[model samples]
Target: MHRDTGRDVVVPEGLLRIEDCLDATGGIALPPGVTLISLIERNIANVGDTVAYRYLDFSGPTGGHAVEMTWNALGVRMRAIGAHVQRHAARGDRVAVLAPQGLEYVAGFFAAVKAGMIAVPLFAPELPGHAERLDVALRDARPAAVLTTSAARQAVDDFLAAMSTADRPAVIVIDDIPDTAAHDFDPVNIDVDDVSHLQYTGGATRAPVGVEITHRAVGTNLLQMILSIDLLDRNTHGVSWLPLYHDMGLSMIGFPAVYGGHSTLMSPTAFVRRPSRWIEALSAGSRTGRVVTAAPNFAYEWTAARGVPADGSGIDLRNVVMIIGSEPVSIDAIRSFNAAFAPFNLPRTAFKPSYGLAEATLFVSTIAPDAEAGVVHLDRQGLTDGRATPVPADHPQAVAHVSCGHVARSQWCVIVDENGDELQDGGVGEIWLQGDNIGRGYWGRPEETETTFHGRLGRTSTSGSHAAGAEADRTWLRTGDLGFYLDGELYVTGRIADQVCVDGRCHYPQDIEATVADASPIVRRGYVAAFTVDGDARVVVVAERAAGTARVDRAAAIEAIKAAVMRHHTIAVADVRVVPAGAIPRTTSGKLARRACRADYLRGTFG
Candidate 1:
């Protein structure tokens, strides 16, 4: 952020620092009864002129263009868009934002929520290969208005035309809304509990569902995320290429807003086209302060393998804290990424592995940025038998799982059995979360929403650090993720819903999939899916071959994968299928859609 932001409300030097806003306890505190919009207003009052956001436009005459928006401008534009949205939709109506990732999208997202309407943050119609997700979310949300930019207007219109929705939403070109419209903007008295946005789940499974997030959920979780990562240790700037529609990507907006600092962003497409741009953005944004960025495990691997320059040249990651989350954390990927950048002063502790889901409003726990991410090798049999027994890192059956971190203050997590009875540390079970950050529930599926959002603590829950904090019979958000705690830190294993059983012993497909991935170089990493095949009763492993590999013995590859799995897991594969590259299914966020693959196989779609 610039020292002077170009003012709407200039604040004194005393209020300039976030550290100065600490409460009597000498700890950070969010003001009582404040909404995300009001918090932005507070920051505007404090540092309205400071640059709040900067977008790196990759499509330009010069190959790149930088666009900056100050707090004052951001505030004015959000209000302007809000006013225009209010004219088309009633308060509390759903307004879908399908704008491209940039200042326009951010402003419109904030505006819809500020207008007291539920904002549905989604992507433009043309992002390749996610049409099903777009269709599902649009039909489910049934938005009263579609917020988009002139660049995406025709595409958005065409997308809507194909949908069999009850009504065609009024489409507004958000960038076309002028700042002067703020003069007539009605400031909505938004309650903290109001459903601010419908955050759609990253479809690791079929049938996408929307999680209802509130202003309070967003605000408090940002605090949790920032505090966990020690973001405000210095004047901080956030840099990200994660799509803003995703929960983790929202931090690009929240972190800077919370700290009254600057955030540099680029479209996910920009980062994908050239991952080196990520490092470049990090280096450039260092001018503002320490840079905090987040991404899934694969990104780190991809960037390390395909993005880094051979020369140490110009890149410095010493001031960067990269939060890795939203999926299973790969210890090997993290270590390799760190080692690849060691020549450039990248800190060993730069990659912080965190665990979160949309149901918990996206942040649950994370290894502190100052510490090396925790890794424990658990005995494979012990883990599958419901014990998180630590084993030597070199043990053949040792499963290396990264610890997400300790339970943060004011948040509670209790491992529970299928019956909801609490389990002790080292006992693998469903992760139950209880915190202000937990979202209310799913958008319209009442039955699923109730089961997912409202879970009670078992009678015998009183031993660990999480016990006292988690009251008896208190409700928890069942994470549906299988994990166990060891030495106070949480280690997530896999998703309960994705687990497959063989001979009454439950097995996490990730283990089998990992074994199969290493069977041969022919297998594409992260593209293997393990599941049951009894229309479905027997175990099946389906993996995609590496792209561009022309001549190969398909039978030989399948046999190699099956032998590797049996050697490692002692489970004979009922069937092994080696399909062409990109033949396997994956969620929109790029996770292997295992169940979807299983369905495709049963339907003979793979043949």
Candidate 2:
């Protein structure tokens, strides 16, 4: 029988079969007292020459080559960087890493952690126009040092040139460090309770806040992922294009290292430039062993749109398991990817949709590795009433949602109504989470921390004890998202702040945005945002036009968008603004920043 997340849960038959396989395969187990530092040390001793990281460097003199690093070699560089960092900053100090995406970035991150400092991975300010974001993070994190490569050192200098000299952090180029420095390095012992890193949340709503992840929290979440992804009893390899700065990307790199698995890393630019590389990399990895990778929903849709030939191009994907997360899991995206890649041998069971945030140290829960994603077509009206009423696939008002599986075994989640009373399965409400994976709180923001981290359930439990109150002091995280459960699997509906209420009827922005995208040809796909003003009781849509569509009639496109939303969601649109491409804001991970768009709309920034 499958184990429950926290309370008694009936094991779904599909999961039970997975458990049986686990028993047959001798399920994977997490190594005790594991930290990134410890994992590196162990791997250095046991598998020194085993490839720990393989960065696909496109700009090298050779023009696109794998920059390989073995456990031992990586260990030496990390120690040297650690020595340099410790010489300048004390333990617990924040060191901002603004390196190009390569070995230097990985080494710098580990080095900071190895020196007992809180590592902050951030994009180099010069590339991708992240100067504003970098400035904001540096100001908030107040890092004592900044790490960069020789190539990006000039950009880092330019970025620091704007800040006050007194407040500026000392910049260290990772490539300039001497190998001899490692011999002089004295390693710091890490406590499980010590803060490991400050992973800033993707700023979809406002400025990003650093989430304080502890060593204990990181180890716990890594185990949660290893168990959830079925990494044990299998030779797991990874291919990832996620940015190293984000938690998801770091998880892909970090989790594999901790599990003694190897991953092939490519810059996010590579995947966006040619989505087929991700498919090809997965195919290459699968030739030797089972391959695991993760990406946001958009990447799947983008890859499917590439129309890779059914001739396969020597791509065999039967042994690949793609873990989709970092945004709301889209049933449409998963289905499209499956259908597009099926002719090339992609198994229907390959897509595993999961849910998580930075506050939880990365993963929360995911579908069982071997099973195909479970989808339920629910009536939109049922969603409004906070009940997930499943309808036929062909139902007129049906909206399909993919299951994010049960909560991580190490974690517990409770859905609570507006008043904070716990809601049973099928009852839609805010998702509150409790677990060891939960972070300490938002760094340097105690008020926001208390409000976000310390949520409590209202009313008494079935046993007549207060679920949470004075004795507990908001023990659960107030995840600002809305979702419900069916058959013990969680279905995230939408973000609470982005929910659109027009004419007393509630609508999810994603549904409306998807509707608008499909309604018009000129309006670009994946660049739409839908939201309502505070006092306005109507829907407003802002969509970016497809490139080379400057000649297209904006007024007609707006009309089409409004008509589409009215026909599909049956809601009248207050206004529609069609702007040029790249006008709408998106998070670093490529999720549409709806709140930011709304603010821009009010400020007439769109005009």
| Highest TM-score scorer | 1
Model 2 lDDT per residue over 414-524, tens place: 788889888877888888888778899999999999999988767534532213322355488888889988887888888887788877777888888888988878888
Candidate 2, backbone clash total: 0
For model 1, residues 358-440, the per-residue Cα lDDT tens digits are 88888888986679987888899998999999899999889889989976656788888888888888999899898778899
Q: What's the C-alpha lDDT at position 371 in model 1?
A: 93
Q: Rate the local accuracy (lDDT) of all candidates.
A: 0.82, 0.81
TM-score of 2: 0.91
TM-score of 1: 0.94
Estimate the TM-score of every prediction.
0.94, 0.91
